[model samples]
Target: MVLDKFNSVRMLNTDALQADFVIVGGGISGVCAAITAARQGLKVVLIQDRPVLGGNGSSEIRLWMLGATSHMGNNNRWAREGGVIDEIMVENTFRNPEGNPIIFDSVMLDKVVSEPNITLLLNTCVYEVKKSAGHKIESVRGFCSQNSTMYEVTAPLFCDASGDGVVGFLAGAPYRMGAESREEFGEKFAPAEDYGELLGHSLYFYTKDTGQPVKYVAPSYAMDVTKTVPRFRSFNAKEHGCKLWWVEYGGDLDTVHDTEQIKWELWKVIYGAWDYIKNSGKYPEAETMTLEWVGCIPGKRESRRFEGDYMLIQQDVIEQRHHEDAVSYGGWSIDLHPAAGVFGEESACNQWHSKGVYQIPYRCLYSRGIENLFFAGRIISVSHVAFGSTRVMATSAHSAQAVAVAAAMCLEENISPREVYSLGKVSELQKRLSRMGQYIPDMKIRDEENLVKKATLAASSEYHFKGFPADGEMQALDESVAQMIPLHKGDRLGKVKVGLFVSEETLLEVELRVSSKPFNHTPDVTLETKTVSLCQGKQQLELTFEAVMPEEQYVFLVFKKNPLVQLQYTKERITGVLSVFNTINEAVSNFGKQTPKEDIGIEEFEFWCPKRRPGGHNIAVQSEKDCYVFSVSNIDNGIDRPVQSPNAWVAELNDPAPALTVRWDSAVRIGKMSLFFDTDYDQPMETVQMTHPENQMPFCVEKYKIYDGEGRLVYEKTDNHQSINEFVFPEKLVTDEIKIVLEHPSDLIPAALFAVKCYE
Candidate 1:
């Protein structure tokens, strides 16, 4: 084979093209920079040396995307955001439902190509950089494999997101290659006195289960597996899907300098280990599972670092120092992989820090010498010891967000990276980040509005009914009877009742509906007799009722039950007297009934049937635990009260029915509220509506409800049904009370409303 080199220097037309910014390296950081700039309406050109976009996480390497932030359900802090990363996640979740690595790579590639503003040059390598006077980068030249052509890319600004800091190195920027001495940076994990060897890299692989016997062949030059000790092991195969081992660290070669050599050694170790497992016959089923990957590119933990405006040191991390320019945060402990030359020892050389978080400043993202250039990802300026903590992909992604935003700001303001550090511009950048949902605790927006109002009710030692008078004198059943009242149970009551009265002059056209699950057994307490006479303009009405106590609880009254009461009774010494009558006034008129009948009179209703539990009559008391209350008064729209269902008759009812209207005296502000309904018997959720009352608009609602078996509505609301009407929140609200009317239009089991959450 003959190596071909055409020429050392090639001239290209400079005036042919122009861009506001140019990004080198199509990794996550570079892509994010380009995307961020483009989203701000800036012209951007992204150049990549490889066919794929993701640097470490790509099909070429098959490395999993790990970050400090939660992706899917993985809760890693400093969760990053760039439309590009979000696009990749969304596409991956759709294309590869199983989340296969190969498909994930494809999703990443799609995002790069789909961005209209991004011009991606694949299979291209940047060879040289040309600068103008005074160390300002002029143009970058690269060799394109696809066209077999060399081109010059000239832009006002450039970003080096390459994991190895290749562009910054060629640009003659100040940088550090290895760890600093313990005394130099005062880093606890640093080498004794001087910077020397660095943490080596690793080549990760995985295997899948096929439930059949298989065999693995060891490489002829493979190291003996019996001699190597496992570093990381997981025995719970079911939890992790399968067994995984990350045993060896160093291959006795510089990962960046001798990548090919390290890859070869890793391949041998993988096959050799598998061969040992297969030959041992300890895992008969292991034969079916094959090595899914060899050494995809070696993942380097340490490399060249571009000197930035500020050098983040280990002390800064260990001290938990806060900076006005803090643009990102990292939580991973200080983990230093064993250095080269320390191999095959009983005690692996490593250092671990206590659980703590660190703040990384924005000044560390730009090149110190290269005024027009910025650096992000693993190559940011930091001592090797500090880099150990910041090198994690999640932190790197956060750094990428900082770099992208700064780059865009630089382009828009016609300034350089150095200018961003002046006049508190860096802090401004940090503020912009905080506004974008980046977790910067110092500038957090907290909810301070009081959601519940303070109220004091008159205490009753003996039952002195205040609202109305009965024809017969009331008898005191027991002293403990007052304690059974839900309102007397202290501040934390699960539910409370508010009375609503309409006079003869008031014409009510209200729609009352409860947003929570309805109850079965009607309360034995009567609200009509409990109502007070209204003075034309205003009237105060009070109702006395009991709520089964669980523990000390907070309760809020949203609605009151009219013509409803609860009965409390206990077993007596007299035998065979198993039932008691807790009745209301005989003359009190029922809503739909023209004349009250003796049998239809309000009486003690038992929650549980006798067949279910014999002699358990005390458990049959019908209180707030057995029914939901909703009311419509002349003053406002409606009120809703969610009660616990003890009778279990309404336990199967998933949605709230439209029985009456709830009117509020004034427009109430609801910051956030959710309505849950049962759609299917299995899922039983029909719909969920979350709205902001102050804005008088819907935040989100689920339309297509889920159902369960037996045609019961499982999930009442569907995703499509739920939608945010507007992004902006208004000051005032249209209606104080939100009416949730359940309609069982479909031939499915009646859906029940489980809960409603109102957050201010």
Candidate 2:
């Protein structure tokens, strides 16, 4: 790929580009605005200064993307649809394998990237926006870092998504900073009089597991925090020490204007805390852990808010007043951190309101002067008292969505934002958002009964239950006991049912079972299969599985299996299955491995099983290169090893050219496995079962198979390819052992191998 010249100033001809809307900031709000406009078929240019898309929640800062619904105790309500936010979530799920940092960023990114009409320019900063005499933005001038060029971008509409309202400020848009007197907005929490004091900023950090001891050394300029503070406000005085408390150091510094000083102080405090930790030796096992994050950029809690058509106030928030122009809701309390100049405990306040939630008006999101300009995020027009509640990330995200929709409306009508509002286009905007899966509960037009019915049907269709009754009954029915049963999908109704088990206690014990077919297996893969049983006032069950190779094959588990209950297999990847269910049910499983298959060049394989108790069983198989052992057992521990192979193999070179092992145990049941050759690498390999005589253990084998690009089998073992050992073994086996090899015809690389398992 040819690289573009860096730092070379150049400007593209204006005739080559066209966009109906331009969104500055590239933060959550900007990205959402671009997505919403693009989805409406309006071309949009989204300019972000940072390389990464998310602003505060980006990996660089690592701030959590809190939404309005989040503070309201319903996190799902934020970013309800797969817009820019949802895309970020999906991407984060893939990028950040260990944690959900990237998930948050990717959710926002996905929306921007997936939109056909959105043009994203990262590493670009908009320094100036030119407006017409009528107070309408005509174009924006941004400097691109990659090309070192400044370009003038023109669009019919402009949006200010910068958390600080940088674009609005440059465009001479009216905006306010700091507190408004309580009298101005009738806000209960506002100060009696106006003041410039604002909430201080913070430098957040995160840590992970550390196996070894860690030590911290105080910085040279570290202050004696203990001497300068009042008595500690302990959450749990008896059990916890106030180490984290020492890290707090901000007081009297303007969060926005004096950010540099604030950052320096925070750094000193951090180093001091680390020093205290090391000297105190309280965290001995924290050596291997990482700081993960440090004070890179200070998170400003308060800044300049662009003045819009209407300013949302604390009165509206406390009263939960429903406004005709309301676009979003906030449930977080009026949590006003101490303004600059307060010290120690006096610097913070945590007063919270009861069940009530605040409704934010739409009029507070667009510019009061700039006709085509709109604002979202923390900069939305809200009084200090109301800003306390709406300032949370969740509320900001909802505000983004509202502004995006309003922008789209403006683009469609080719009118100013104020005109859109005056024409009562906000209701249509809300309706459009609702159709896109945004959770605007107030705008829901569907009846409660219809919504409930749809939800009920979806729940029933996707629900799956597995386990055995403790009483040894095949069937059990107890709504109360069954209430504990788990579902694979959807939110838990907090109601479950168990059939065939009965107990005097209100909560009955039951064991759940789950199983899955191999990914490359024949026919359609059975994602999960399990049987639950309840016994001895407790639940106990055993799951046994085996690989019956009809051809050269590959197989693996794709379901729950983890002792920590933190791991599970998706269709194409492994992930933590942690969700709302874990909190309610204390059940966990173990990780299991993929199934193994081999070439037999034979018609069939079988073995004899000696009957024993209905519990664990062990099976052994020997190949020309190794001996494989598998053990299947039933335990009441609820921990299933889903990712681990039940069988093990040690290769021995003197056996037959194509080795085969078959075993039978009541504890094990045969599932599916496949084999692939180089020719079928880009196609689906086929499965063919050869006839075999019945025995204590019954199974079949095939000679050859073909594979495809998607790991699917295309051609089955036929009479022409009757020999399993048709291919020559390489002179030197790269590894010491021989395992299942899947050859991709499209590539020169050798086949992939997997472990083998059989029924116990």
Give each model a TM-score: 0.57, 0.55
| Model 2 worst lDDT run, 10 consecutive residues | 679-688
What are the per-residue Cα lDDT tens digits for candidate 1 across 1-760? Answer: 7644776775543322467778888876676667766765677788899877777666555444544321111111113332334334434543554545566666666666666877777887888999999888998888887777776888888888778777898999998876677677666567542223566656656666767755567768866656653431221212111112133344334556776776666666666666666566665556677655564676666678888878888777655677777777764445565543223443333433322345788888888898888887889988887787787664676677677777778877888887888756876676445333344422332222222121111111111111111222222221111112222222222222322323333322111111111111112222112223333332233334334323221122212222222222232111010121122211111121122133211121211111111121221122233222111110111111111211001112223442112334555555543332221111101010111111111111233332212233323333322111112124323344444334432222222232232334
Candidate 2 lDDT, 215-326, residue by residue in tens: 4555588644445434322211111111132233343454456778887776665554444444544555555554545647766677888888888876676545678776
- List where candidate 1 sits over 4 angstroms from the true fold: 1-17, 69-97, 193-196, 209-215, 228-253, 340-343, 346-356, 445-760
Q: Cα miss at 537, model 2 (Å)?
A: 16
For each candidate, the alpha-carbon lDDT, in order, equals 0.47, 0.45
Q: Distance from true position, residue 378, model 2, in Å?
A: 0.4
Sum up the clashes in candidate 2: 96
lDDT at position 89, candidate 2: 36
